[model samples]
Target: MNPPTPSKPSPPSSSSYSSPQTLLALINNILSIVLLSSLTIKSFTGRWQVIHSKLTSLGSSLSSLSSSPHWSENPLLQSLLPSLLSTLQRLSSLSDCCSISSFSGGKLLMQSDLDMASNSLSHSLHDLDLLLRSGVLHQSNAIVLSHPGPCSSKDELSFFIRDLFTRLQIGGIECKTKALESLLQLLSDDEKSASLVAKEGNVGYLIHLLDFNNYGQNSIREHATAALSVLASANDESRKCVFEEGGLGPLLRILETGSMVLKERASAAVEAITADPENAWAVSAYGGVAVLIEACRSGSLVTQTHAVGAIRNVANVEDIKNSLAEEGAVPVLIQVLGSGATSSAQEKAASCLAILASSGEYFRALIVQQRGLQRLMHSMQEVSNSDTLEPVLRAISSLSKLDPSARLLSSSTTFIIQLGEFVKHGNVVLQQISASLLASLSISDGNKRAIGGCMGSLVKLMESPKPVGLQESAAEALVSLLTVRSNRKELVRDEKSVMRLVQMLDPKNEAVYSKKFPVMVVAATVGGGSSHGCRKRLLAAGAHHHLQRLAEMKVAGAHKALQRLSGNRIINTILGRTWRE
Candidate 1:
């Protein structure tokens, strides 16, 4: 028999050839061929040199990856293998063509092919490096072995977050979108995840996804912005990070052009980010004030609420207040107040208007001109909860600082009755604010008589030891109320009311409450042809000692009050002279 013929070596089948081990072997083979071609090819030696270097680096990375314990199990690597293999195969074919002695392709065509191959090789190398750096391979292996479910513990959740963040950095748009959805779900379900995202410095990646050009879909941007909103709402540090990472510009862009749902989500993010006073300028600097104002005018109620809230926070910065007014926020805010939006939205609009009104008379006049007072009064009647009522009352108080607003408010019997009720029964804050508003409204004589019905409540507030501002406010309001004859008569009729005012004039109480308003109140009560019995009641209330002390200290209205109390009695004249000395 002839020597047995050696069995012909068979070509590798498709499935086996595409296996991880086979792919690694094929990559090594192609890498060697490209290196040899780079050394020998003379026509485009420079291009080949660059291509060779890239392939060498890629080959080294592939070698290291193949040596990893779970290299075959890594989904990212498995998914990437086919494209990488195709690219390497094309690179090998181009190297072979360049090395051929008798090539038909033109010199320019050959040079172009070589340049394309070099770029392909460079891209492959970059992908491999990103894969190795991403830590996804090991994370996948660990995940598979442990089979983490639902992230029961912090460590487990951290592991899960790391995987999601890894995908966010390296995954394609679709992959990133999925990761963002999962991230938003996690954030919505668990408050701690936002803090973790901020701690891990992953906020920038989410912000990067906010760009529509990068993601190419509103869904992705919506999900990412919603996630950022939760993140910003959950943690102060995250809000700072969102602003510092330039999230405001993208958010404002969304407000400008995004769909209603997307704009709502972006507005929420802006609202959260601008909650910090330091971040307010970023919103204005990015021209967000106008965008927010427009959103307030035309966005959905939810969007308007968030936009108004963001404007409220942004207006906290003194410098941005003018910008907000210049951007025509006053009318839009007034519109929101009257548009039958949710009570929360109306409250935010009221608060934002309050801030703007406090900035200067221009914003105050602008708000009043737009019928803000009417809208605010309507809101006050519509909503009864303290939270909504507080801001509305504050806005009314701010606007009432303008005489026009005060005149408008003073005419509303409903407004005066509400103030009296709030002063008597509302929480301390409401009572203080209501008392202050009464003082503001009392600038009108009609208001003083209307507010006089609340004199009993005001007197009770002054007698309370806490919140000296409330005491001062009630005193000022009483001063205005006493300018009318009926209010002064009513005060002396209630002896305790006179006692409270007299008590407020004590020198020791000066540090607790200002003595000027009380002195002014006493002067108003006794001067301008008041009854002698009222003076007797004030003298009997031990007002002489407090007024003498205040007079020595030269508190405004004190000496005049003392003289008014002294009046033409020989004993009073001698006593007043001794006190004056």
Candidate 2:
């Protein structure tokens, strides 16, 4: 029996396998393979990550090197600017593409680094602008630096500008003076740098350098005043800094006592600082307006130019304007307008005169008494630049609004004719002022006759496709001129004049024409008498249709115009309506 049992067990081994143990071994082999593959993948991923980190580090280093001041100084590095900018732009795009998890909890840090790199590339471009200003970079290379950015990141560069100003203030005198001169030259048109310099309390130091006790050399004074001017005009904050740092007193002293160069710079500084009304009154309180007026009257042309600018800055203050006028600024400005001064200087003088004249009727009369109108008209004819013409026209316009001065404009046929010519000028402001002055001058019969010669031009304006504002102004001048019999006779001669006037009675034109039609009311009454031919011309030009339309709409001026046109007894009888008047 034992032999038989052992034979049975040995036979069972060949027919069947151990299913549980075999399956367990198969699972262990599969798991081992999976583990090996995972380890291989992790190793390659880590290596790739290391390479990526190194590339990012390299990029950061390149970005830093590009921002270095020496980067532009070296011709080799300067040549790489376009390439470096390309790389930075790519890095910026990549930074934006990254997910939050990609930075391993340093997403904010990564974004800040990218922003800094972008700004660094931007600041590097300004090196060429700086070099050009310093005469180190040639004009040909300016195109390379002419990218859209120009040190415009004010908040970022503010710290560096503050440091430069600090070094200029506390460092050695000659070195600081040279540094400041360079800075002023570089930043004269850069509002951001000037603002940063003023914000760091460096404006006080700049002003302090104006004193002879601190920086006695005229060169230093000249540089300091120039720097102050840049800072004072940078912004409202810089203007306040100039005011708070006693810049007004020192600038006034320079105006009163400094040399021509110093006075020129100081006058500009004062003008910039006193743009604020408080600062302007402060300068006036310190007797600066009188000195400014004297400067305008007798200084060198450069000095006079700066002085006139300063006067304009303060001319808004009533007391200052009166003081300037009393000190004979009116005559000086009038003379400058007529003289051979540069167009820029003439503009400033005319602007200042306009401000003074705008202050009161007394000022306007004073300017007229000084022959300002004659001088302005002379200058107007000589100059073709609208920059000069605009202010001169504005001054004439302002003066001509007053009854006393309107008479002055009416007395000069040449002036009236000059204004009528200006109505055809390409400048819209000149057109507006010319038209407005013509309307004002037409209040007098003599001026009406003078403006009547421009009847064709006025009719052309009424038919123009120009702005409704200009069309409205022309209509106003026409209505005023037509009140005079000779002016109406002139309009009747121009075939299109009546039609143009009719075109002006549009429902859309009510706002502009409403104020000018009291004269139209008088014209209708006057038309019934000897102005019958003028009335017939108006009717023959299809004015009856527009007048009827306007009357149905209840426009106040339309009814009178309708009644006047309907006063033709034959036409009235044809329409089967009797004359009511």
Candidate 3:
């Protein structure tokens, strides 16, 4: 068979050809050739020298890496070694051609190959540098040796986080992305991890990944943002760090152009960061106020809810409230209130409007002009949970501070009935807000009859050991209601109401409750020709003793109430005691 023409020895298979030891041996051989060979092409000498330097550096890194246990099985090494071997082989071939006396390829082609080879060498060296800097070699060795289980202690977990954080700092895109996924999972599961991240100052790396400009790394950006959201929600320090690292701008950009899911996450992050009122202006500085308003107008329900909350937080900064109003937040928030969104979203929207309205009459007028009052009333009518109802009531309370809003609210019997229910049975907070709302609406005589039904509830609030502000608001509401004669008769009929009013005037209760509103309420009770048996009720409740003490203290309205009581001769005869007029 012609001596079976001996087949040329087959080249080594790629798997064996690119083994870690083989690759390292090839790199060292190429380095020697590039350093020692005399090139015929004078112009190519400098480029070959550059390749020599890179190969020497890469050889040192590979040698150090090879000493790690099972280094050949390391994923990073497995992935990079084959490509690195291929580049080194190409460089070796180019070095040989340049060193030869008889080269066949065009000089330009040869030059082009040299440039490409140098570039390939540089790229390989960069990747190797990343590998060394990433600390993956050390991590891989630890994994192979001990085969560690789940982190059993905070120190172990912390070391793991620091390792992952180091990977985030220097690695290929895929390596960094994997690190981020692991980090996000850790943060979501462990509150302690979030705190650790903040304490270790790794928060800036997380914030740095918020760059939307990173092409093809949308998932990285999203996970980074989600991680930040977890950190912010869990730790206050993380929230402040997020702002300090200029994270708001990237977060807002995501809100503007990111996917719906991304927008939701970004909005949530913004919401958490801006929860600190001090960070409010950072949002405005990044022009995020307008983006948040636009989100309210069009984002998904979750996005809208977080956007509203972030806007509300920003609005807490007194200066940003006007900026929010000017950005047309009023109309969008009104729309959110009237939309079919979740009750939480509507509640936050209401709170945002309440904040804006609190800025001044200008925002209140804007709300009314935009029908926010009607929308809030509608929201109030639709929801029943205290969480939702409280903000709605507060929004109405704030908007109603305007005369027009008060008039509009006073005309709605449903609203008045709702206010009565809240004042009667709602929690102390709702009771206080409702009482304030009633005080605002009580400016109208027509509202007096409708609101007077809450007299018993308002009077009972005065006896609550809660904050004095509630009592003050309730007493103020009662004073307004007492302006009508029938309401005064109603108050006098409830001996408990008269007694609570008298108790409020005591010098002992002075520090606990303001004497001004209670005195006015008592004076209105016994003031006019309609005093009837009300004067006896006051004296019977010892209103004279407390009133006299208050008058001595020069409490406003105390002297007037004492004068009104002293003038009641029938009450004096009934008590069998005479007072000097």
Show how many residue pairs clash in every candidate, following the order shown.
0, 0, 0
Cα lDDT, model 3, residue 241:
69
Q: Of the candidates shown, which would achieve the greatest TM-score relative to the real structure?
A: 1
lDDT of 3 at 322: 74
lDDT by residue (1-581, candidate 1, tens digit) is 23332232232344667567777776676666656556666457677777767777886898778766666765555556666666666766666566655667788988887777677667667666766764555544543313235547876676667767766665677777777877877777777667777765377878887777875777777888888778778888777778787788988998889888889888998898888877778876787888988888888988988988998888878767878778788888888777778888878887887777777787778888888888888888888788878888888888887877777787787888788778878887789988887776645566567667678777777766677687788777777777888778878888777777787889886433567877877887887675576677787778888999999998888899898987767548655666577
lDDT of 3: 0.75
Candidates arranged by TM-score, highest first: 1, 3, 2
Global lDDT of each candidate: 0.75, 0.63, 0.75
State every prediction's TM-score relative to the real structure: 0.83, 0.63, 0.82
The residue pairs that clash in candidate 1, if any, are: none
Candidate 2 lDDT, 1-581, residue by residue in tens: 11111111111221243333332233233323322332323222443343344344444444444345443433323233443334344433333344222444464665565555545544444433332223222212321222124745754345345434534543456656765766675565465655666654357778888887675577778888888877777788877888898888988888888888888888777877777777788866788878888887777888887788888778888777778877777887887887767677899888887787677788888888887877876877788888888888888877776776677667777777777777755477777778777776645677667657776676566555556566667667767676777777777767765555665665555433452342262353236347777766665655676678778878666677677777757876644442232
Candidate 3 lDDT by residue in tens digits, 51-79: 66776787687777767554565555555
The candidate, 1 or 2, that scores higher on lDDT is 1
